[model samples]
Structures are given as structure tokens and as C-alpha cells.
Target chain A: MPIRYPNGQPYSRSPKQGQAKKPLPADTYSGRGMTLEQDIDEANLYYLSQQRAVVHKKPTPVQIVKVDYPKRSAAVIREAYFKQASTTDYNGVYRGAYIDFEAKETKNKTSFPLKNIHPHQVDHMREVSKHGGICFVLIRFFQSAEVFLLDAKHLIDYYDNQDVRKSIKKTEIERLGHQVKTGLHPPIDYLRTLDAVYFNGDAKERT
Target chain B: MPIRYPNGQPYSRSPKQGQAKKPLPADTYSGRGMTLEQDIDEANLYYLSQQRAVVHKKPTPVQIVKVDYPKRSAAVIREAYFKQASTTDYNGVYRGAYIDFEAKETKNKTSFPLKNIHPHQVDHMREVSKHGGICFVLIRFFQSAEVFLLDAKHLIDYYDNQDVRKSIKKTEIERLGHQVKTGLHPPIDYLRTLDAVYFNGDAKERT
Candidate 1:
């Protein structure tokens, strides 16, 4: 069998690496630090190299309306608009299980606000899970550099009971979620916990 | 359930309509032209409103390195890099099943060229099928305006045999594919086919 690359692709990584190295970010984002997006991107690389599982963050969807071609080599977007996404931030296949998730980082140390997640995404995860897909969210507290993977079931439960509150408490997240320690390559190996949870049926072990 | 806007968000359609009217073609590259993406976008709106299922096009992922805050109202991306996406162009849940596929339009009249598709997408769809997800591609011949849904199983088969010949014959796609007739509300009612294939157990219909 041919080796499947991340995203179920079979291209040489060197090309992708070359594309990734093209002076986009000096160090992942506007100098505050590596944004949560960057951290998970590197983590995806690590997971790919070790053949852990294939997961990726979907790119920010920007609507490019006008492009100026001073030269055919360069396509500069002149007039474009940003669109809101309907699904989660990340989703991919892992160990023959469809794994979908959204990653959010909050500044508030006490709790992660539900506003960070859109309701359409909440509906999406619910539908995915109803169909037997494994869905969750990877929450990071950037100030603390702590990561937690909260299952979608918990999220839906919280979302359904909106009459209660506006946020998911950090303490509750810590208790109900699995912690993902950041690493060098594939910085966020949240799938390790996914395997132990969904596939292995030890999802309750996190509690 | 609260009403979801066109992009699957639980919001009013006012913002999206205002955004879509901005006349930027960057977001219009779904290759359907202004009317096409709008049709599908509208179709998605109808589907969501009716509670059929949730589906959406994956956003184009970009790595932003430098962003300039010219004003408190808007932030401009000064420099950014394109990232490789690891999944298909579209994915979502329908009637309790995971649906993933890429949409492609070809000008060629004789054959649907495999080159129009990336290897990574093939890998992603294969993985999606492996995980019990519903996977397929929506192929349209703009000259004829004929839309067909070809199962990923058949697509991967033809893709794997690419060494022999590098194209999917029109006859082949027609023989193995299911045609999607355009409809009101959401222009492309492919979800009807999805319900037929996934929930009603119509896989044998194509076979």
C-alpha cells in the first residue's frame, strides 16, 4: 500500500515544507507568540512524521474578489472579504475514525467563553457525532500554555442548556477534558487521548 | 432550534448578504462563478433552515505572519502564506452521516482530467471512506452545465490506476456517477442524493 500523507495525500513533504517556509511569518503570528493555530500546525507535522494519526486545522476562508496580476507569477488579492466558517477549526481522520474538532484559546484564566465557538459549529459536531464520528474541541489557555481536549458530547450538553450560563468553566474543562502536553513536532498530539477515549472506549478515563 | 445563516452559523443572513455583495472574486473561486457559489450557498441556506443536515465548504487556510491594525475597526493582513489543506473542499453531516467531497468543474468535453484533482484530496477521501464516512466528488462540465456525483470509491479506483491513463472518461463518470439536478433555495440539492445514498441504502443503485 502506498503511504498516505497527512490529509490522506501522497505528495513529497519537501514540497510542502518548501511552501511552508516561504516567508509568511517570521515566527508564527504578529510577534505576541506562536498563535494556537501555529502550535497545532507544528503538532500536525509531528503526528504525521510518527504516523500517529492525520488531523489538520482548516485554513481561514477568505473571499478573494479581485486580484491584480502585475506578473502571472504573483496573484495579489486586492479586494477581498472574510467569511464566517460553518464548521469547527480542525477535522481529519485518525486510526480509521473520523475525528473532527475546533481549537480555541481564551485569555480569561477562570473560564473559556462559549462565544469563542459558533453555534453552527456546535450543531455540526452534534450531527457528526450522531453519525458515529469522533468530535471534540482542543482548548488552550495561552497564558498558561495548557491544552485540554473536550469531547463534543460535553459541548452539546453545555450548548443545549444555554439557559444556564454563557461559558464553560476552566475548572470544569480541566476536570472533564484530557490534557495535551505540547511537544516539538506535531506539537499537539491530542489524538493519543482520542485513541484512548473513542476507539479504546476509555473516554471516561479522563474523569 | 435557532435559525442558522447561510454559512451554517446561528445568525441572520443580513451580514453574509452584505458581505457577498462586496464584489470580491477571491471567495468566488469555487469555480461556479458568482451565480453558482451563490446558488450553492443559497441551497445550503434552505437545507439548514429545513433541518435536513449541516454541510459546508472547507475554508482556504492561510498562514498570516504580519497583520496591520490600521484602525480599531478592521485589521489588514500585510503578509501571509498559503497552507496545504488535508481534507476535501467540502465536509459536513447529513441525516446522521459524515459527508465529505470536493467540487470540480472542467471545460473539457471528452474527459474529466484527473489533474484537476490533487493527490492529497484522493488520500483524504480514501481515509474518509475507511472511517465509514460518505465520500464523493461533484463534477461539473461548465460547457454542458452537467453535474454528477461520483462516489469516492470509484474515484480512488480510477485514481490508483492513473499510471495506466491519467483521466476519468466521461462515459466512465456517467456510467458510475449520479447526476445532481439543480433546485430552488439551495441551487444544488446534492443532499437529496446524499439521503438516497447514505440513509436509504442506495449504494446498489449505482452498482
Candidate 2:
């Protein structure tokens, strides 16, 4: 029988329970069990440890409704619901420039669907770009285990132009976006691409 | 009689339930019902509307342990716990520069206690500053309704110096930090203070 919570409702374990318990292999580049979010988190940690950049993934937004404060214990969140995020998932400072981006992984092989990104997120990326911040989207093709860093300008143009196709073709992405190489130290080394595209291959020169 | 949740646990209202329902006064400078967080949020909204800056408060972090997915409805988080934030509460981009800060309100009349800021936060701020982000803390004296923007450098200096006092004296804060004036539009005009100190009173010039 399924476990029941205090209110008589059945309690269910998270879908990722089995995967979370599984031990990671010695090599992550194989990218078998690791998710794109986890890869980026590991990269961010690596960046922070080296004092290279200060990027972080924002916490998941939740609308907390009820909390229980028991004696001699931490407050327990009894009831809550997830809320849509207003901004991108990741942001940070890189070489005195404000960096912001969203990461998404798709199983499709030929193209990246536009449905993965929301309208508000496009507007936010546009606004961040207008304010002179380095804004982009990191798209990973799960089938090929490849990642690409596409600047927000290209994304905003496609999002705003009604005549264009709904999804961006893999060929077009190759032409417009820079490919991010995976490595052991930092799973996704997108900063190397950023250095070439935005900072003229030398971050110190811009600052 | 109190309401009972599905698990037979009694549901108690949040501590801020009463204040959440109260209407705000027309004049916020009086700050009768407004919290420091609320005032900064209002200011951030104002900044976003004007296309001046893109600052935001990171959402509260929560660890969801159990969730109930009722068919055709949003998933309800039944069991969770609040997690401590790893970084400062607020951060954003302004005039092509990275900005980061934390806000705190003190009811004390003479001094702002140092215990309010955690050691890890100081370390995080130090890391941010080293990475070239404009970092600071917003200290508000609840009794006086006055707010000050203290640079992270000053706070770091005091924190690292073991011989110094435990709290920052109001007079010392007045000497080192710039006073943030309250205005009708943004409520707390911290950007103006930033303009004077960091941007030489002209944000465009720095950009």
C-alpha cells in the first residue's frame, strides 16, 4: 500500500528517486545519467572554486502556503506550489560584464523546438541584451550529447519575426551559435566560447 | 476549530497572515507597514519599468521532499523544508556593470549588529568583489526610517578585523556609507546612491 500523509492523502516519492540514488560513473563526459542542469551546476562549481566567474542557478520559485514550526526543530514546509520563473535560470558576473542565460536539453535530433522557451523568457532576454548584458541560451541535443551557446540576439530575432519557422534548424544553429566542448574539469566549458565571441579571446582586454 | 490537512495534521496560517491582508498606506516613506524587502522590490520594479536597471531578488530556496500530483491539477508540495541561500539575496546588471547586494533592516537605535550577516555571506561577497562585481549591503534603521548603501569592502574590512566591535555604529556607517533617499516613485532610491558613488553621478559616462 502507498504511504499516506497526515491528511489521509497518499504520499508519493519524487520521480527522480531511483536516479538520485544511483552512483555516478567515474567519467561524466559519457553523459549517460547526468542531466544538463547537473552538468552546468558542476561547471558553475568549478568556476567558483577557481575564482574564474561567479555564476549561479537561481532557486526554483515556489508559492509557500503553509509551514509548521515544531518545538526544537527547523520549520517544515507543509504546503506549497511551484511558480513560473520571471527570469532566466542562470546569471552571473564574468570579467565585469553581466552574464545571463537559460539552459535547455531536447531529445530531438534535427532541430530545437521553440516551445521549449516561453514568451516572457524571450522578452527578458531581449531586455537583458538591450541593457548591454551578455545574454544567451544554452541548448543541448540529448541524442548527440552536444551543446551550443546561441546568443540572445539570434533568439530574439527568431522569436519576434512572425514569418520565420517555429523551430531553429540544427544547420542554422551550427552557423549562428558557438559549440561548447565538454571536459572533465568543467563539464560544459561555454566560457571559452564566450571569450572568443564577446571578449575577442581575451577577457582582460575588455575590462 | 482549526482546519485539518489531508494527513490529519492541523493547518496553521502563516505568521504574516494579518500583515499580508493589511492595505498599504499611500505614503511609503513613512514605511509604516512596508518591509525593507518590499521597498527594494518596489524599487526594482520601478527600475525595470524605466529600462534603467535589471535587478531582482532571488527566490527563497526550498527542498521538496514529497509531492502530490492530483490528476489535471498542479502538483502540490506536501513535504518540504526551507534551505539557506548560498549567495546574496539581490543581484542584477546596471549600465553594463554587474551589481550584487543584500538588504537587512534593524530595529536597533544606535548600531547595526554584525550577527545579522552570516560568515558564508561575507565569503560570497568577497568572492563577488574579487570577480569585479559591484557588491554592497543595504542597511535600514527601522526606528529612523533611514537606509544606507554600505560598500562590501567596508563590511569585509570590519568583518575580517578580529579586534573590531561586533556591531557597526550608526555614526561610522554614516561616515563610510552613502545615504539612500526615499522617493515617491521607487520608494527607496538606491540607484541614485550608486550613481554618485560608483558611476561618478553619470551612469552613461561609465558605460
Candidate 3:
């Protein structure tokens, strides 16, 4: 028996799954164990503390139906439902640029499924990019602990042409996206990749 | 009997409340009746439709505690609590600039109380401003049907020096902030106010 994605595609293990790898330092933050959201949150906190960026994850949107206010106690939500977000998960200002992105992790090792990216999110990324915001997606391969910063334009292109292929092959992602380095201090240093891709590696030009 | 705020401040009517006012045209959108948040949402929608800007009100932050997954239905959240937001209510991008703001309204005609703002929000705005994002507060005076866009710096200054005055006088807001014009299509034309204040009345400089 093999695990399968919601779309019925069979999951396969990565070729390097059993290969020996270099061990991470004892002090490495998160140590490739935290979820992508947690890693990004840690990085964002570090960024804020250093005054390098002002990014934040939008709170989980919930459709609250009922709440009870008890005497001398805080209101407790009695009924609610999770609501799909209208925009990306993370956004903020960095170096006078509006930065927007969604972070997602895929257990599939061969390719990243298109089903993980919603239509509204693609529309949002397109709109943000059109408005001159730096838009991208942070994709993490859970099994291999590899993260890539794929520009929104590339994802949008592949998403719009999904009839040809329902998923983006790992090779295509490696070719088009910048690999994010994981280390201590701030687990995923995507900003360094952003500097290389968007700002032409010159961070002080705007300053 | 006068209405009172949550802080127990006695609210008073504006001096011109009883004066005869000019009648507005029947086509004015929202007609100064909607809440500040509604007006901003409407304006943001219009801006998006017109490709003028991309702004959105972040959803209310909720802490979801328990969820039940039924056999053939959407998951229902059974226990949750509303959480105070660490940042402002609204943020977006416009004209290659990161825009962040909080919208607040008060029925009191004389002053806008500092107590309406939270310290964490002030800290967030300060961080945003430090990162070169345009940060401000949209204040609405319900009694006068007036909306003013006050730069975050002004509010932060008064907030930090709160020992002198617990509230900012309406006159001070008028002196330091730009009055947002109300009209159809978009109920609040705040981007126009932003143009005058932050962009020096030039909308084409960046383009």
C-alpha cells in the first residue's frame, strides 16, 4: 500500500531519502523540524527585531457564527468555521518595496502539486505583481528539507497552463527558483534570495 | 443623557450639529452612513477594480481551539477565542509603496482618545514607518461626518507623550491631517489624500 495525494496521484520517495547527509549543527534554529509556517514566523520575528523588514503572517481567517459573553469572563466563541483566505499568508514592507508571498510545503518529492495553490491566491499574486510588489511563493519539500523561493510570475504561468501538467516538476522548480538556505538565527533566509533575484543584490541603492 | 464611550468619557455633540446643512446629492455612495471600516473596504474595492491600488482589511484574529470533522461535511470549530491583533487592521500596496493603516471612528466630536489605540499597534506602525512604508491612521468623526488621515508619526508622538493630554483635540487632527473627501464610486477617496500628503500631489513620479 502507498500513500496518495487528494488528487489520487501516487506518492513516491525521493532518491536521496536513504542517502547519508551532513548533520546540522546542534544550535541550528528549528533544525529542519519546524513546519514552514513556524520557520517563516521565526524569520519574520528576527527581521522585525533587526529592523530589516516588517512582515507578518495574516491571522487565520475564521467565520465566527456564535459567541457567548459570560459575566466577568472573556467572550468565548461557541461556533465557527475556517474560512479560506482571500490573499497570501504573509506580506510586508522591505526596502521600500511591498513584499507578498504564500508559504506551502509538499510531501511529494518528485513535484509540487498545483492543487495546493488556490485560484484566488494566484489572482492575488498577479494583482500584487502588477502593482509592483515583490510577489513569490516559498515552497518547502518536507522529506528533503529543501526550500525554494519561486517567483509568483513563474508559478502563475505554470498554474495558468496546468492543462499540460497538473504539477510543476522538481527539475523545473530547481531551474526557475532560488534555493533558500536554512540556518540558525532565522531558519529560512529568503530575504537573501530576494536580494539576489529582485534587488540585483544591491540593498543600499534605495537607502 | 449623553452617550458614553467604553472608557467612560462623556460624549458631547458638535457645535454645528443643529445648524442647517446643505443637502447632499442622492447619488453619493454610502452617503456618510457606513462605518469607517466599511467605507475603506468599499474604497479598496473601487481601487482594485480601477487598478489604482491593492488594499484590504485583515480579518479579525481568532484563536481556534477545537474542531470537529464530520463524516461528509465541512469542519466545524467548537471552541475558540478572539485575540487582540498585533498589527493594524488594514494594509496593502499602492504606487510601488507599502501602505499600512488603522481605521477608527468616534462619536465624540471634541477629541480622538489615545485609549482607542493599542501599544502593540503603535509599535507595528513604528516598525512599518522605519521600513519606509507609508503609515497612517484614518480617523472618522461620526458627529461631523468627517474623515481625516493622520500620519502615524503624529499619533505616535502624542501617544508617547500621553502624560500631557489623554486625547488629541479635533483641532489638532485638522491641523496635522488631511481631510479625506467623500464621493461616489468609492465612499472614501483616501488615495487622493495620500497623494497630497505622502506623494507631494504627484501620482506619476514613480511611474
Candidate 1 residue spans exceeding 4 A from truth: A1-35, A48-52, A81-83, A95-97, A118-133, A142-144, A156-167, A181-186, A200-207, B1-36, B62-66, B78-86, B160-163, B198-207
The worst-scoring run of ten residues by lDDT in candidate 2 chain A lies at A18-27
User: Which is the leading candidate under DockQ?
Assistant: 2
Per-candidate TM equals: 0.71, 0.84, 0.82
lDDT of each: 0.68, 0.81, 0.81
Residue A37 displacement in candidate 2 (angstroms): 0.5
Instruction: Output the worst ten-in-a-row residue range by lDDT, candidate 1 chain B.
Output: B20-29
**Cα RMSDs of all predictions?**
10.2, 7.2, 14.9
* Model 3: residue B6 alpha-carbon error in angstroms: 47
What is residue B128's positional error in candidate 3, in angstroms? 0.3
lDDT score for residue B163 of model 1: 93
Which candidate do you rate higher for lDDT, 1 or 3?
A: 3
TM-score of chain B of 2: 0.82
**Candidates in descending TM-score order:** 2, 3, 1
Which residue pairs collide in model 2, if any? Answer: A6-B7, A6-B8, A7-B6, A7-B7, A7-B8, A8-B6, A8-B7
- Candidate 1 at residue B62, lDDT? 60
